[model samples]
Target: MESLRNLPLLDQLKDQSISTLVQTSLIALIGVLLLVKLVQRLRLNLPPGPLPLPIVGNWLQFKEGLNPRNLAELANKYGDVCMLQMGQRKVLVISSPEMAKEVLQTQGVEFGSRARNLVFDMTTGKGSDMVFADYGEHWRKMRRIATIPFFTNKVVQQSRRGWEEEVDLALNDIKEMPGSTTSGVMVNFRLQLMMYNIVYRMMFSRKFSGLHDPLYVKLMTLNLENNRLAQSFKYNYGDYVPSLKPFLKGYLKEVWETNQRRLSFLRDEFLNERKRQTGEKIGVDFFLEAAAKGEISETNVLYLIQNMNVAAIETTLWSSEWGIAELINNPQIQDKIRNELDRVLGKGVPVTEPDIANLPYLQAMVKEILRMHMVIPMLVPHMNLQATKLGKYDIPAGCRVLVNAWGIANNPKYWEKPEVFNPDRFLKEKIEPTGNDFRFIPFGSGRRSCPGSLIALPILGIVLGRIMQRFELLPPPGVDKVDLRSVGGQLSLVLASKPRVVLKPRQI
Candidate 1:
């Protein structure tokens, strides 16, 4: 035993057990080292990020995980562009404006690829999902179909009434209460409005009617705990634990399946409605057009419907929520906006489609809100078809590019006081972001920028205009507006923060 080392490699291994064990152990160690180096190389352009190790990656960097404050703090330390290693993926984060502009605008095609996560695969199959689809024919086709019919300028003109009516209902809902405007209502304004404008219009072409509708009811109620949990679960992965995804693939799958069931229910309803119609093909709604006579498979229809719901639902809703919160916190901005609306529309009159044209201040508020608060902060990752150079880095073909809209939205080079919310900055000179200057990006940019952009503007303008026109949004009794904090799903454009406030109808 004492002279075992001196016996040499061959002699020690002659004891069959030792040789077999030694061979296996050596092979495993080599494999692990090679795998690690491969992963290290995969995390390209290091970009000076915090230390990330094993399965967790840089998720541990923030105790709360990528909150607005955490991002702000990271920028202070690691410049603007930082690569955060999340699980097996290199989450490249840019906290600057110029870099963001380059990624989304000039180098858009090069950087236009989506992160092909397990959730995407499980939900949409082979990256067929529009939001996460590759920047090629399929994505283009799907997007074109959506934009041409539902989101084009003409469609937006058509939707003006829907938008107006929804806002009208909201205004009425607030004022309808005989006893009090802010008493015994107990509703989530953000969630409620999103349903009416986004999900309701996008899917069935109407609003939810009653509590008997389980899916709509379930959707409207905020599951803060589950939403946060689902978010935290996805960001928990790394190269060291490459085979660990299956253990935690519940949320997205469950949601997709739930949506599928809902679509089945919708299909049945549509068929029944068809029976009632005298004699005609399916109506001009998103669903009827996509799967009339079930041309598209039920599964695809389900996926499509579900996708539409989340995208439309969250973007419009979150924008309104944060914008309102911003206004509530900055009463001066609120007062200024109210004055502008009054000057444009006047009191004792419901806002009209023609009236929207004159509301520059309202337009500025929405633009500013989008800039300061990005809906989908980072555009879907843009995939490069061929090799090209961006900045100092010589990017290879097929490398995933993250267009950091978050960084661009708050880039100090383009935006002064980027963090502090201000709408006037948009009014200065010419500030229309036409993919050339990405200083303000709420709905992404380029050919792949959200098709719903046109559809959304009028909807947003109408809702925001009507609400601002009707309500006196006030801070709670003694709470300071300066301390307002925002929170929401990690890595999402959705921001749900600030406690609820009582809204009293003020005379216009």
Candidate 2:
């Protein structure tokens, strides 16, 4: 019996030795293949970049997250158009306004499509949504369908009155908060609720009851989670390095599951409800009508709603917060805007969408906010369909392009005293957010420029203007000024500290 046990143990040792040998052989084969690929890559006359290591090219450089600050430092080292090796992939970081136009506008078509990795592919339903969809006939059709309800001048006109009322309701909510009049209130939470309500009304023809509502809370929670996952540089690292994916399977699975839950909520709660409606018309009726006519698929409709909620809500919420915080910090600027509102619309008069046309200072202030605090600093990444030359640099086909809009805006070469928060700069020179002036492209440009700007501009102006009209904005006690330090690694830049302010209702 002892001999039989010894024989079995010897066989087990032999099996282990064979497994170890096979693993070693496979690794050696892979290393050789990677070396060949590296040699081929070096042979190409690509743009200059730091030396990359095998299998994990330049991945270590962006451990802090590939944010504006990181990209700006790289720009200083390498000229405007610098190449970065993110694993096996090539990325072009365009830091200057001239290069930005060359990629985003001049040759927008060449780099028109978005590059999706494993995560983006699942979240965007294989890039069917307009924002990430490849530049093609399908994308054009989707954009047209979306424009009817979201971007057109008619939609903005129809939604303006509802938006004004929502702002007033939000102001009342803030006023009702305990000690809001004297001790002040944290406006960030309430402000986010208000911004969501504005977009919610536009999308569903109604607003959530308040922040405490169960459905509202659940939706907000899911949206926040989704945004965090989408923007997390650490979470999405596998997208840049394919070899790292086996280790990231669990993380990717969670993200996919979360996105599915978000989509399911939209379908069950919102899309199905719209489909059931007969006598009543809602904001989503246009989409439902198109679905019925087979002009757009049901899946695409659901994703479009998901796109609007995620894309429109948080960015707009933060923009409002930033604008208001800046106003509180610069009380003189706040007073000037209030005096302008009083002059144009009279004291205590609620600002309407059309009133934005007459408020020059308000417009300038908003532009300054956009310039100073770029919401989406690094705009959506673009992909090149073919090898292209950008200013004597040979960019390989399928390389990703990231336009550093924040860097461009803050580059001292373009704007004098770039760090200062002054709206007066715009008063001297005329610039449009239309993305035509590459130096100040907050909304992006070309075929994929943000379509919601027409709606966004008026809504932002109304909310900020009305708040200033009804209240004397002041900073929270003990805090001398608004903290401008941004929390890094978000899809959009967000305030590290949620701004707190006292909204003293004017005695008009």
Candidate 3:
């Protein structure tokens, strides 16, 4: 009997199997409980966020959005600091000025590193552009050298006249536009012409021509249409699912491939231009001029040229469009701005740098538009290099941080009546930072903030101002309210590139 007992009593086979099943079930239940506890414990120290399911965190909340009004809404609910999920990438979004100040200002270095994602790296030839490069000696060199020629006050002065000159051309084109009504049609000519010309002239030393040319078409395609498309793909699998990326099943892969091909072709053209200028007296093109500075490499020069085209053109154009849309929507804003312009420039003169100082209301309008629609909100997902503490929280090494400039700029906590389009918020009064407590500078702050702000704003102010000065902007017949919404899937929040008209020439 003792031997049988030790030997499982000659094996009551069915009963033994039942016992095993019970044990297995109990183990699985305990394991699940332990996993839940473990996960909760691990995430406890992280910032507040919506409850996350395994494998997919808060990704379902905000799709790979160009403009995440959803995220801002979450800030209203979950407090200013929220955590977003993009596959394995962890995004920490700071939606209030307090958090923004902590991340963007007092604790900038802790959150100052740039993202090391595969797509961004591949797009930038592994971040050859100064804007996207990782923080290190090479990045420093890129920032110091490339920024010198491109962003210097001297460069600002040089480009200012060029911007005015090209704007004058756009004005001339608008004036000469043949039409029976005499009022200029509300068209996105700025998309095809002026905005592209400003960046093109600065980069390649001539106005961008050849509408049917692949370069022109590529630049043309890069406008509002592309902004929506790109934003769509960011939240899709091609950007995240490793296995699915190679064998993509959606339009995203095709779109990416086509654009990648265009980028390659454009890069070759840019490089060939540089190669041709190898020993020649390094001409006026920004790429060549920067390469002459010794620290900035030829590859970096090409990168700068490409970025100057893509970066300067896209952001400036889209932002100007928003200012236009805002002006159209808020005629009072436009009327006030136009009154200032009329006072400063009188009639029949295109807006130049001289006219900018006198137009504070216009400046405020631009700032307000930037605040409401932070074109590249989150300001390109800064990274963490060294381990540091953000207030009481311990921000681990290699953590990626996003300063939610969109919410910070528009939070009622930071701005009075965050929803309404009021430029006066930026005018005076010290308010809590949606991040840093400086006057509402939409360009960003610190060493890694956009090196192009000084250039970008004036381009916006001038383009918008001149458009108002030269032509009277009114919504086209049957088009009321200037209702414009973004087409999704871009990484930036630019208006969907539909043509909106302001009655030019005759109507005013």
Candidate 4:
């Protein structure tokens, strides 16, 4: 009886000992993990940022949205080279010109690759296009092919007359509008059409008849929807957090559907028609030839067209709209432009591509507009292909690096009264939009700088010069100035309100 009771006691003691051992082991494992994490953090000199919470990281801070203005506020708090833990993704926001120079130019090769997200992957066909493709041989090939026909000086020479003709047509249409002189007309749609025609003609060798052309309307509507969907931050939670990916099933499906529709439209309407008809080699022909030779895929060609449709057309249109609005807001600036035009290119002659070089003030205005209102404020987020050091902080490979072009351009440290819409600033300093000076990189610098700048700058000058030459743009009656409020997008900043202005025919 004594031995049986002792056996039971011994069994109970054995069970308690095993439980104690298990608890002690668990505690020790947890301690080791915490120590390892602490040591790893101490080893890496990471940039300063707001403390990230568990799992979600700094996502809750961005409940409103991720835009240039919001990023600017962050810069104001955390210095120029600050880190933002956006869920699992590491984002380094560069605000100052010095840091921008380092990331964009000095370390261009290191930071040349693009940061791909779920939405961009779907839209860009998994890096089939140049804009979103990783910086490598494939991107090199696409860039070379795109530059040959669309962005070269020779293309500008060949296409200048056509561009001028389009401008004249636009001007004539505005002049014919009822009450165009007395009451202001909303010319936003007309301008949008003109921009589309310019790019479409270059890409497809075709132009829509007018704003009401069924094809034009369909294409514009699709592009608008595509931009809205692609540029939204709502569907990006899944991108930051892998666990949340299931929630994006419906959203991703919609994006897929929209992309399919867009691709089909491009193929059936434009690419297929081009295939049927043989003509003098045009922009599409260049890509087709490349595809035929196995240089790229047919799908790549379609993605290229998509890029031209969205990137080339929309950004230029936004810049032009902002430029015109500024002119309407400041009449003296208009008079100054008119005087410059008269002095430089004769009284009534329209500005030609070659003439843009001579018109200093007009070029200044273009530069100023680009500086004040950068269409692509963040300049397409860059990625480091390998681990790199940005200033004193260690930037891990695959971190999404953003050069806040808007913040840099508007930073008072670099610019005096950075908020003012003054063209004289450019005249005071020889800051071209060529991205040579880090302070005013309207088009980003280094290897990935916008190839379209060669064509875009001249186009802007000609359009603005031609319009100002023909008509005196004025704000609508009872309005002192056009509303210059802007709404930010994922990649672009656009005028919040469509500007309405009266065009008084100038008798030169």
Q: Assess every candidate by TM-score.
A: 0.79, 0.92, 0.82, 0.92
- In the range 3-38, model 2's lDDT, one tens digit per residue, is 997998899999999999999998987788678757
Q: lDDT scores for all predictions?
A: 0.61, 0.83, 0.65, 0.89
For model 2, name the residue pairs that clash: none
Query: Which candidate has the highest lDDT of all?
Result: 4
Assess candidate 2 and give its lDDT: 0.83
Better of 1 and 3 by lDDT: 3
Pairs that clash in candidate 4: none
> lDDT per residue, candidate 1, 1-508, as tens digits?
8576678765755788777989999888767856884575676444666767555566565545455456656777887666566544555555666776666667777677665544445545656656767777767656654555566666666656766766676667655544334332323463465455444554455556543466555554423333444355353452214576465556555645644445556456543444355533222344445655544544555455545655666567777777777877877887887788777667756676667778778888888888777766666556666666667554556544555666667767667888888888877845754455566666666766776667566667777777777777665556566234555454475544445555677674
User: Residue-wise lDDT of candidate 4 within 1-508, one digit each (tens)?
Assistant: 8898799889999999999999999888767755754575689998888877555668889855577788888998999989888878889899988999999999999999999889889999988998999999999999998989899889999888888888888889988888789878988788889888888888889999999999999998898888998888786679888889999999999998999899999999999999999869899899998999999999999999988886778888899999999999989999999999999889998899999889999999999999999999999889998998888898888999989998889988989998988999888878887888999888899998989898788889989999999999998889899999998767888999998889999998
* True lDDT of residue 195, candidate 1: 50
Q: Report how far off residue 251 is in candidate 2 (Å).
A: 1.5
Best by TM-score: 4
By summed lDDT, the worst window of 10 consecutive residues in model 1 runs over: 178-187
Off by over 4 Å in 3: 1-44, 63-67, 175-186, 210-215, 218-230, 238-260, 274-297, 428-441, 488-490, 497-499, 504-508
